[model samples]
Target: MKKPVIALLILPFLFFVSSCNRGKAADEVNGNEKKQTKQLDTIVKKTALTIDTVDYNKRMVAMSNNDTTGRWPVKAPYPLPGALLPYNRIIAYYGNLYSTRMGILGELPRNQMIKKLQGEIAKWQVADPTVKTIPALHYIAVTAQGAPGKDNKHRMRMPFKQIDTILSWAKPINALVFLDIQVGHSTVKAEVAELEKYLSLPNVHLGIDPEFSMKNGERPGSKIGHFTAADINDAIDILANIVRKNKLTPKVLVVHRFTQGMVKKYKEIKTVPEVQIVMDMDGFGDKVLKKDSYRSYIYREPVQFTGFKLFYKNDIRKNWVMYTPAELMKFTPKPVYIQYQ
Candidate 1:
């Protein structure tokens, strides 16, 4: 009886000790989690501060044309002011694998496409030897055609396999990849979110074409679409988050525009250190009309950066030669981004 009494007395002590130990372990884990969370918060705050340091107020002032000759300086401060742009200049081939008429990006066999890209890079190097030219494969990951899919999204998201395959195709040649989104009837925010995983990669960038955004329920290709500055901001904000989390170089955002209606509220599109916005003039015409379009639209607007597009079939329709590297250099601030499609 005495032995049983002693055992019973010891049981409570053992239970108390076990409970104390379990509590200690739980406390340790919670403490560690809090510490990590605090550290990440600090890092994110620092990133936001870095963006705030860039005086957007001075952006317009800096892009001013102090030069009277109307000549775009070859060494102009470009891509963005007060920010480190990834490349001295970017020249990309745009298209999708399914369409030959779209552009040179995916018209040929995989091996042949890589070879042609290499050739174009070599030629651009000869054309503008002063600036570093980056070769990019602009994959139309999503196509917005006239018909709405069964989902009725009015947009078709490229299968992950296709995007991955093209990204793989760019690897052997060491070219950067750009995933362009037409959005069809979808919203830019939703479309960009779907691509967040790929956009987080260091080598991949993004392009949003307001031309097919279809802000309304109107069918794509029936009328030109529009993207407000708010829409652009949403995309930029998403990219900025990826940059901060991954600690990456600034991501480039190519905004395709040739008409005022395509991109509304231009001034409201703000910039952050983690992303660069390039307002590309995407129009096909003769050299004279193209120049006028560039001057009247892109050059006149003064966005964070400027881009020019050349059409193999359309640019040469009326003129003997497309605007060469030297001729494009004549704008007040030269276009640092050029696309051939």
Candidate 2:
């Protein structure tokens, strides 16, 4: 009888010990998760601080009178200026061939010409060895001026016939291709619907041009139409969903901003943890703004990744500058991407 009583007592002790250990393990796991969450939050906050407000009108005014760096407003808590960050690896730009052609003659053979252009891009990889073999992301711009859609219904448009050639060529090279839309008469939701066919492809991304999204009577270059932070966030949400459904890597949403007003509602933009958003400072000119001025005014916005553009002829004379890649590599907060025109 005494032996039986002892066994029962020991059984309860064992159960108590096991329960205590399980609780300890659960606490440990919870603690680790909290730490990781805090780390990610810090990174997101830092990225948000890097966005700056650019004023094109002020810049143009400055440029007309030969004021090189344009006029950037003064702000507080200045970060160390200069090329303090090396941009990210994959870089892209508006297609020079299509952009230039559309700008001048206002027309081109959309289908055949794009295919030939893709072949030319393949040749460029070999011709310019310095063009960064890091497999760039290309944004093919579709506008009303060229490749007009049937019945004037913009949303009915599809990727140009030559787009397949580019896609095929890019696949072999391990590059990414994106369809960029100016969205003159379409909504963000509408444009995404048109682009749904390409979402299944692994190496494709998306870009939106607020520069071309204007109200009635506004021209592309007039800076009349701008996207609200909500508009941008909505587009990001749609892309994130598509990326998740297709089991693809995070989709990249590229936004071109030149001034503070362009991203006025930046603070209100929603943050989607799944997607990577890049805001590029798309300004053109030769004169360098005071590196400190840019950091204080522009690079201080809330964003995940930052981008910079170096015009082959405009930003750097002789297609080169004193700032070496090594020096560029030394930036404290490196740029996520760099673009060369």
Candidate 3:
């Protein structure tokens, strides 16, 4: 009876030890599962960080359009974060709010202009379907005048109230605003400095017209003007400074060009991560002439990006019709910026 009683006690102790061991094994398994989950989460975060570069490469490929010329995606350093180019296409209405002859932005009534711009945006969306199309009001903040202004610069600076009006309009539609400068006899640095207040805004960008740059002692419309690489670099420097100071996203700088002489030493134009440079084909003509001009000036001497302008009255004067978004998309390396005047 004593031996049986001892045997029963030993059996209970043995069962307890076995149960303890099983519990320890379960705890170890759970600890390992938690560690594995943490490691997987880290890997997912790493993948998320690389999405910007991957998307940039894909857009470059799409912009290339399988061209054999090798000039479409001009090799350049990747832009800093929050860049607008190559990701979204900009459709801008070019004009001064005061002049009806400049471009569509001022040609129509306020309500009518926004409605027209929205229609154009929709058309581009349908044509591309992949890229997002955004609207812009490209205001001529400093317009080149036939007569010399008070400063003898032959450029009229618009009032701040007008720029404020543009901002007011852009706010409701989420549209970008471009302050275009036709420097006339004045320097780019001077004109750009005057507009620094507006340019400091997040949505306000810049456009410099080489067509009226006027380096020599002649009037703006007397001859087609030019801007050297050095002049363009000055504008870039100012924009970069503004971006860093305000902790703003990158700014887009559009340089208008049609002839080879319009932008001298195009190869030497510097592009910074803070500023995106676009060499725009601003001449208005029939489709063939415009394409040839783009091939000669914009395509030959590559910039960070390219833009194409369509004149409502001028483009149709010879061609009898405007080039549709579908037709323009067929060009090599597709223009990411479209301006209508």
Candidate 4:
């Protein structure tokens, strides 16, 4: 009877000890999780502050032409965590893979073209040592065609393989890739949806050429085409959704505009933090003409950012010279994105 009593007492003691150990283990795990979460929070805050420092706003004011008007710097919403505009200068090479006549991206062999791009990047780096220069391959994924294909869109879509090739090249260099759309008769919404898989990537961006939008069913190249603010908004909305869905950094959207009609109702274009919009001066001419075009369009109608395009052949045809980075930097709100064709 005494033995049985002792066993019952011991059993209760063992059970109590086991319960305490389990509780202790749970507490330890919870403590570890809390510590890890706190560390992660600290790192994220530090990164955000580093990326969006006070200097970004200061630089914007400096770029603005000392205007009392609030429109110069465009009081758009601050971008989400990983925005790049006004922070780094993008030096891009533009072209389509099918035709070498389009631009330098396809004009030369891959190695030679990349070398040439690196040289240009060096020049810009030397010109503006403060801002880092990032190289980009701006591929024309949708090309406007003279003859309407079976789809009757008046545009040809490059196969996925070519885009894959561009991505493959970009990986080795850590370069950004921009898939440009010339939407011939197709809408921006439709064309952009097709490239969703690629654009979901963090480094991939977007460019829309109003010069070939061709909204009136007219043949592309017959006359300069136009895109309304609504058309541009379609792209912005899509990009914003992609960024949010994939938990990616903000994506850059380049809008090519050399003339007033190329982009219409610029004021109505909504500015979202998820996408950075650059109104690129898409003309090729002497320094005087190029500057005039930029001031007339980009400067007067301020967007979130600005871009300037340089044509290797057309820009120098008139003056036999291209505008140096130093000279181009003198413009009010200097271009943060520079494209060479």
Estimate, for each residue in 1-341, the C-alpha lDDT of model 2 and write its tens digit.
02223444454655554555554678775665566556545555544533232332242232123323322221112221111111124544345234553221113343443454444344434533433334443544455332235644332343456457557656655667766666755666677666776855666777776665654545455454577777688788887788668756567677766665666567676655345666666665433452342354345664545555555445565443533334333332333454544
Q: Residues 79-179, candidate 3, lDDT per residue (tens digit)?
A: 76678988899999999888899999999999999999999999999989888999999999998889997888898999999999999999999999999
What value of lDDT does candidate 4 attain over all alpha carbons?
A: 0.87
Error of 4 at 214 (Å): 1.4
The sequence of per-residue lDDT tens digits that candidate 1 reaches over residues 116-164 is: 7677667767765756777788888888978888978788887889889
Tens-place lDDT digits, model 4, residues 135-216: 9999999999889899999999999999999998888888999999999999999999999999999999999999998888
The models' CA-based lDDT, in order, is 0.75, 0.51, 0.87, 0.87
**Could you report the Cα RMSD, in angstroms, for every candidate shown?**
14.0, 14.0, 13.4, 11.7
Q: What TM-score would you give candidate 3 relative to the actual structure?
A: 0.85
Task: Name the better of 2 and 3 by TM-score.
Answer: 3
The alpha-carbon lDDT assigned to residue 21 of candidate 3 equals: 57
Task: State how far residue 100 of model 4 sits from its true place (Å).
Answer: 1.1
